[model samples]
Target: MDMDTFWNDFQLVRTGNPLVLNVTNHVVTNNTANALLAAGASPIMTFSSREVEDLMKISGALVINIGTLNTQDIGLMHAAWSSANAMRVPVVFDPVGAGASTLRTSSSQELLSLYRPDIIRGNASEIMTLAGEAGQAKGVDSSLGADAAVAAARALAQMHSCTTVVSGEVDIVTDGNHVYRVNGGHALMPRVTGLGCTATAICGAFLAVNRNRNEAAVDAMALMAIAGGMAGAMAQGPGSLQMHFYDMLYSLKKSDAERLFSVTRD
Candidate 1:
């Protein structure tokens, strides 16, 4: 997509302010909420199984992050996915640290088999692990590059019939057949916590307005990279970058997006 299309999608988030329901991990809840708000999207984090049904009815999209999963949260995630499917709302799944442990791997696989998410975002190792390939994962950090996981990501996307994203120095977004690589984020982005989780939330925000899952995934990654790059230029370190990141996202203009946007299709 071009800068014009990207700006149009960005404008939709501001004008519509679509409500996004996130059943995300505790660690990134605040960061994800703040990122969504900065991008002009309403965020509601609810894990109550009873309330999720009603919340899905009013929400435009749902985000499921397994960063800090438990038996109860797993059941709640299943319920939320069911509600989202029934309501025909888009769902973004972030299988954080998928290859880190047996539980994480199994939980991600189980969710993928149970419900077809509209989008799945993770690091190279996470996506590769989900694809049933051996991957190197040091906790949540990916030891492999995004380029190395392209084939695995494509396979996973085809198997699940959804958009798959592998985030790294160059973020790779694919929907089985088509692929897009977005580049621009700063090196310091990984130093901060919950940025990947925040990216998944941003994907939900973009999917709320865009019907094409591939475009929505591309748009979200592009926005993240652009904002991160801009913020990194002024910040002294990760701490300051985190603060500036929010400010850049809030004040991000069409011109900024037009100037900073970079993507290549495969």
Candidate 2:
């Protein structure tokens, strides 16, 4: 994929302002919504099962983040997935903290079984755990590098027939056959809360305009890394990084993306 392809897709989001339905965690709801808005996409956080079907009909894409899960949330996710599938809308799944506890792991697995997400994004440990491998996940943080889960991510993608993304120092995106590596994120990213969740929302925004799952995943990750790098440069710490991150997303231009994006495919 070329920078032009990514830029064109991004422009679609800016011009169209597609609605992205998010059944995400409450902890990062504000951050995710702000990030989506900054990237020129409309975000709707309606997780109620009663309203999900209607919301999914109008949404261009759906995002499911299992960061903070509940029994009711699972039902809502199923409803949203069904509606999205019927509407032919793309769905992005984030298996947050999959290896942290049995509840989290089982919930993630159950959702995967219910729906084959167009794209699945998670850290190395979460991806590995979802792939039925042993990964070191300490309270939603990946102790292992993203490279360590490349094979596991590829296998997961093949098994689920979906694009898989493992985010770490280097972000890795794959669709079982092709792999793309995105590099440029800052160290301060992990220090802030909800950035990973925000990344998942951004993926939904990208997929709203780009139909190709692999290209959409790669483009979203590349943009996130570029924006994170730019924000990190000016931030004094995690606090300012959070503020600058949104600024970067709002002010991000095609030229900046072309110059800052560091993506390699194999």
lDDT of each: 0.94, 0.91
The number of clashing residue pairs in each candidate reads: 0, 0
Task: Give the Cα error of residue 171 in candidate 1, in Å.
Answer: 0.4
Each prediction's RMSD over C-alphas, in Å, is: 0.7, 0.9
Candidate 1 lDDT over 160-188, as tens digits, reads 89999999999999999988999899999
- Candidate 2 lDDT score relative to the true structure: 0.91
Residue lDDT tens for model 2, 1-266: 77888888888988999999999998999999999999999999986889887887789899999888888898888888878887889999998899999999998898788776999999999999999999999998989999999999999999899999999899999999988999998999999999999889989999999889998998898888999999999999999999999999999977789899788987
Best by lDDT: 1
- TM-score for candidate 1, residues paired by index: 0.99
In model 1, pairs of residues that clash are none
Give the clash count for model 2: 0
Candidate 2 least-lDDT 10 residues:
47-56
